[model samples]
Target chain A: MIRFDQVSKRYPGSDEALRNVSFEIAQGELAFVTGHSGAGKSTLLKLMAAIERPSAGTVLIGNQNVSKLRPRIVPYMRRKFGLVFQDHKLLYDRNCFENVALPLYINGVTGQEAAKRIRAALDKVGLLGKEKAMPITLSGGEQQRLAIARAVVSRPAILIADEPTGNLDETYAAEIMALFHAFRQVGVTVIIATHDAHGISNIPGKMLHLDHGRLTVS
Target chain B: MKHWINQHTLVWRLVLARTCRNKLATLLIWTVIGIALCLPALLYVIIDNLNQLAGEVKHEPQISIFMKLDADKTIVDTTKSRLEKHAGIGSLQFVSKDSAWKQMQDDALTDNIATNLKQNPLPDAFFIQPKDHAPTAIEQLQHELQNWEGIEHVLADADWAKRLYSILELGKKAVWVLSGLLGFALVTIIGNTIRLQILTQREEIEVSKLIGATDGFIRRPFLYAGALYGFGGSLVALALINGIITIFNLSVADLAELYGSSFILALPGWQISLGITACAVTLGWLGSYIAVNRSLARLNPH
Candidate 1:
């Protein structure tokens, strides 16, 4: 569960990115945050992960106030969520297997056990066959899938994505949404920040709309 | 237990991977550290040897205290008793004028002088040995004996020891100053190298931080890499010193013969070697810590 109560985030020398935005996503629910560019969608997700602190707010995940979490505690707080970026953020030098195994490796999983879990995650994302292939060689859609595998490898309770299908075609974007639905079916709380609301209008999920740093609809 | 081992192994593997990624650059950095550390290490070895040489010189220190020519048997008796009670005089043998004259006749160069002199010109003297032959102790003893009654002069063959000791003192100070300078240089070298590594791996580091990798976890591999560089460099420096000692050992025979000594150049003792290694590794760790922490602070993941 995630809650944002009157959370406002302001960068130094700039206006608030999120102005007193408040919303809540219940346990095991999937929600899409729809907003125009510069409408505080990315800032909202960043606040949830404690990546950016709210200038004035109380952002809560479960029972913990993540907005007030210390820097040392931020990483442990992040372990609760699986985060995917629009750019994929995959290491180009490493093969698909290494990139997908990043989360598990960070959690001290290795050897045959780590390998098995890494394979399972890759299989879930349909990237098992491309384990040895480099990210640069993978298509945009496949690269996005690889990033998803990396995110879910640690089996985080919450899954958050910023523009999960930003660079993909309609078919690929639909497929990516389907992947989110599959995880949501298994009781994973999934929240995605996207500019295109029409892309996910047919999907069954709550939609939180943002306009000019304010929560227009939830 | 299994998890702990796995974690350590993963970090070590990553460290090696990163190090091998830029092999030439790593080698260059390590080479620079090795050379930087080698100078102080070599100086330490030299100082150790000099101390040993000084020890050898300690055993050979001799002094002769000459009595005034006009002093009578009472003066000789009083002087002998006074010297016998002196703390610095380890052993003493009285040399009468008759024996001094006879000793000159035994030597080919001084035989004619013994016969040419009508009376014994050599005064009564005490062939004295000090408790310690260190320059300061010998000089203090000389100064103390100069004011003794019926004493004409107190002479010691300690000029060479004094000069060598003075040089060794200067050398010790130089070693300290050099160690400080080289310590700074080593820290700078390792810090700059780690900074470059952080810059190159900024993307990986940022992504790692985002995906639940703690700052400590991200820092582990880089710290190990820096430690490896320092540790490996120190080992190289030790090898350089030992190699120099080996070369010097081979050539020291002629020099030892010239000095009537059989002393050979010795490798630094285990303590000194361990000290150098410890210093180098600590510097490496410290340098990496500073660089990593500074860069990490600049990168705001939140």
Candidate 2:
């Protein structure tokens, strides 16, 4: 479960990125944050992941006040959410397996147990066959899937994505959406930020729309 | 506990892999650290040996008190009693003027001069071994005895020992100063090396942080790498010092033989070798800790 209560964020020397935004999503729900460019979608996702604190108001996840969390506790707090970046953020020098193993390693999981979970996550993303292939050698869609595998390898309760399919074609984007749908079906709350409205029109889920840093509809 | 050990083992493996990946750079760093440590180690060894030799030579400093020629038997008896009661005098032996002349005449080296002397000109003397071997202590005793009744002069044969002790003291101080400077240099070298490593691995660090890696987790590998470098460097330094000592001992043996002595340079014992290794490892750890913490703060300014 995630909730933002009248949250406002403003960067120094820049206009407000998000102003007085509030929303709530129940457990095991799939939600889409729809907005145009510079519409505060990434900023909202970052706040939920505790990567950035809100300038005003509180962001809560599962009864924990993320805005009030100490800096020392931020990393442990972040472990609760799986984050997929628009750039994929995959280390290209390593093979797909190592890329996915990053989250597990950070969580202090290793040995055959980590290997088993990594393989399971890769199998979920249909990247099981390319575990040893380097990320740079994979196709764009495969690389994105690899990133998704890395995100979910730690079995986080909530999944947050900042434009998960911004660089993918429609077919790849649909496949990525289906992966989120599957995660939601298994009791993992999923929140994706994207400017593309038509991409999620057929998928039954809650939609929160933003325009010019203001939440217009929910 | 098992998980903690697993994590450390994983990080250590990663450090080893990275070190192997940059063999030339690692070797160069080790060599630099080795030479830096070796300089002070060699100096300490030489100074330690000299200190041992000085200890042997200055075991019991002696003072000779010669009585005035005109002093009578009663004067000699009074001086002997005073010396016997003195706490600073360990032991003493009296040689009367008549026996001294007789012994001189009996000796082959001094018989010619002794036979020509019409009267016995030797003065009564007390050969006193001081309780303390310290040069200053022996000199103080000599001064105290020289002012005694019927005593002509007091001679303490500790001047050469004092000079050697002063030189050895200076050498010890030099070794300490040199070790301090080189220790600082090693820290800087290791710090700079770790900084470069952090810079090159900037991308990996960023990605790791983004995915919930703790600062400690990220710092573990670099710390291990720095410690390994230090460990390797200390080994090289010990080897170099041992080799040099061996080579020098070969020549030292011949030189000692020429001087009718068997003194040879001894390698530093286990305690000292372990101490050097521990110091080097700590410095390496400190250097990498500072480097990684600084860069991590900059990278994640939350």
Candidate 3:
């Protein structure tokens, strides 16, 4: 479970990124954070992942106060969430299997066991056959799917994506959303940030809409 | 424990793969480090060999104790017995005044000078070889002999050996100073290499951190790379030193033959070789640790 009580984030020489935001999502629930560009959606997700601390608030992931967590423990705490960046963030130098193996390797999983899980995750993203192909050679949609495979490879309890389908076509975006749906069906909590309302209209999930660093609707 | 080992194994494999990817650059770095380290190591080997040569040249230092001219046979006998009883004296030969005077007369150069003397003016003497060849020990023995009864003077011509010892001491110190400076240079070289590696892989590191990779995880491969570079460089240095020694020995053999002596340069002992390797590896690890930590702190500013 994730909870945020009056969380606020401010950057120096800039206005507040998140203003007294409060929200909660139950475990195993799929939620969408909908907002325009620069609206606090990414900041909220960052706060949830403990990548950035809230300026003033209590952001709790499960029972841990992520805002006050010690710097040394931040990495271990981050292991709870699988993050997919807007640009895929896949390591282009390595092949598809290696990119997907990153999270598992971070978690001390390797050898045959890691290979098994990596293949399964890649298979879920429809990238099972291109395990040895380089990311630079892959199509944009394939790259996005590879990123998703990497995100879920470690079987993180919470999956967080920042505009994961931002550059994808409608067909690829729908396919990506279906992967999230499948993950949600298996009790993996999924959180996606996007401004594409029509693409997510048919999907049934809780929506948190943000406007100008304030949560407008939940 | 199995998982921990597996993790390290995986990181090692990754580091090796990455290192092999840039083969020429890695080799160049190793060569630079090797040359830096070889300077000091070669100096050490030469100094060590010189010390062995000095030890071989001077088997033992001897002290000559001369008796007073008025001292008689009983005094000579007593002095000889005392010298023999002394723990510091390894061996002693007593030369009576009469025999010394006769030996002087028997010598062609000193015979004429000795015949001019009316009586045997030579004093009885005891030639003593000290058990300890150290300059200080020999000087101490000479000092003790000087205070003995009926002894006119004690003379020890250990000045040449003493001078050699001091020079060797200075050489050893120079080796130490050079090693320290080169060790620091090696650390800096390795640190810069790792820093560049981090820069080239900045995107990978950033993405790894975002996906829950610990700083340790990101640093592991770089650290291993540094250690490997250090290890490889040390090996090259060792090989370089050995090759030089071999070449030097060939000429040394001809020179020794001309001198009617047999001398060969000895290779560095296993301990020194092991020490060099260990020192290099530790420096490599330290270099990478410092570089990676600095970069990580900057990348993830609090």
Question: What stretches of model 2 exceed 4 Å from their correct place?
Answer: B59-61, B66-91, B95-125, B129-154
Per-model TM values vs. the true structure: 0.89, 0.88, 0.85
> How accurately is candidate 1 docked according to DockQ?
0.77
Model 1 TM-score on a 0 to 1 scale: 0.89
Q: Where does candidate 1 stray beyond 4 Å?
A: B59-63, B67-93, B97-123, B128-153, B157-160
lDDT of 1 by residue, B112-191 (tens): 87888898899999989898977788888899889888999999987877778888889999899999999999988898
Whose DockQ is greatest here? 1
lDDT of each: 0.89, 0.92, 0.90
Error of 3 at A210 (Å): 1.8
Model 3 chain B: ten consecutive residues of lowest lDDT: B55-64
Tell me the TM-score of model 3.
0.85
- For model 1, the docking class works out as medium
Instruction: Give fnat, all candidates.
Output: 0.83, 0.67, 0.69
Docking tier of model 3: it is medium
Error of 2 at B302 (Å): 1.1
Q: Could you arrange the candidates by lDDT from highest to lowest?
A: 2, 3, 1
DockQ of each: 0.77, 0.71, 0.68
